[model samples]
Target: MSSTCYLSLDWPTAPAWVNYNSLQQLSYFTTVFLAAPLALLTGLGMSPALSTRFRRISKLVSIQAARSLHFLVLVWFLVFLVVHVALVFTTDLQSNLNQMYAARGGDGWTGLWVFLASMAVVIGGWIAATPFTLRRLRALPHHEQITQHFCIQGWSGVTKWGGVSMRTILDLVKPRPEAKWVVFYSLGDGPDKWRYYDAHPIEQMSHRLTMLAYDMNGRPLSFGHGAPLRLRNEVQLGFKQVKWIEGIEFVADFSRIGGGHGGYNQDHEFFGYHQAL
Candidate 1:
């Protein structure tokens, strides 16, 4: 199938069993050759090691772009599978089953049983998967309450956030003098999804309002609101305030990090690098 797509072979018109137009042939060719390779390349762009090692390519195909393209590829595959199966069943169910499972030209129950079992496994796995798990907060050296939540979409909320200041953690870590940026990584959509993260200039971390918040509204944060820890950067828009924070790193430059465009939203959504508004 892949070889035929790569060679750009002409669609077969003489076969009586195979009934497809030029449009269908073009769609199949595009899905196999173009979408499949693009999906693979975008998936590779999301890898932390690969993105760092191949900085230029990573920048060109930002992590968020890779995620979006990957989703589109999945949609295409699902559409193709549905159409292909419908066509086979409508045309000749017995012959199709025999060719696929029995590997012969005779009708038999062997193929039907095999298909049923494969579907059962897939459905069982889907049912077994669950949602996010709760994470607990650990002891911190200092905690303070601040009321400043700047939303980027023209609304703002003033909630008291309780947690340790970024400066205090920096003091403990003792980052190198040359470090000019701070990167915060957080949990996203699901366990299978890529980690959500953002980068801020080192100067922004010095602001008194910046901290790793663990409590909101005088209560421990719920899992939906980023339990354990979340970044609170008063100077930037709310999106830059990464939630469900897992780790923090001090780096001299962000060019080697994911997408190399200052932050995830900036790289993918074309948001301003310094969103003070």
Candidate 2:
């Protein structure tokens, strides 16, 4: 295989190896090693003959093996595509390659260094965000509490909640000095498309008994009882403790929020926004 490339500034003679140079070698690698192999394996897997008499070919070329190879080829090529694109766009991409991209161009290391720094920041963020938080919320300090939930309907129940303390979340977000309240928005909505959200004091948020629960009675919360996440404020009525929480926002006040009231049900159903058990 022979090929040619402009890796260096010098335009070498022949640019060939065994009748090829940098470019020829590159073409050979792409066609023979990457594209051609994938195409050949794909064609082989798609043929109906593989499941017939060919199934007993030394156990290496069985129907299962063929299909596995085909699937692996797809995953392999996808990874290759992502890596090559990242290297090109993040490191050495140049609109005018004829005058740039060489080490002698005086900017060869700049893009690579910047790319490394960016990757470091991104990796740091991924680690900090995913391992301790994100959709996986169990990594925070767990606080279990048995409390009574009082509803305006005069019904009540004592339940055990397993969740992270609100203080942990407060430390993570570090709300601004002006942020007096945090609003919890629910996935549920009222008629006329009124979004269901409620505000609570920031001080109550940091209270030891307040939490965002994902487990009830030592089991993962079920959909009937607010799966994934739900607010737990032992000091407040049930409505004030939002369920099926979708998002949260920090604000200075709630008077300018929906219906000039502090919550959705309060706005629509005339319920008290700030009620206690």
User: Judged by lDDT, which candidate is best?
Assistant: 1
**Clashes in candidate 2: how many?**
16
TM-score of each: 0.50, 0.57
Give candidate 2 regions above 4 Å deviation: 1-117, 125-136
Error of 2 at 240 (Å): 1.9
In candidate 1, position 88 carries an lDDT of 65
TM-score for candidate 1, please give it.
Answer: 0.50
- Once fitted onto the true fold, the runs of candidate 1 whose alpha carbons sit more than 4 angstroms away are 1-138, 189-193, 275-277
Q: What are the C-alpha RMSDs, in order, of all predicted structures?
A: 11.7, 16.1
Query: lDDT of model 1 at residue 265?
Result: 73
Give candidate 2's TM-score: 0.57
Top TM-score hit: 2
Whole-model Cα lDDT per candidate? 0.72, 0.67
**What lDDT would candidate 1 get against the real structure?**
0.72
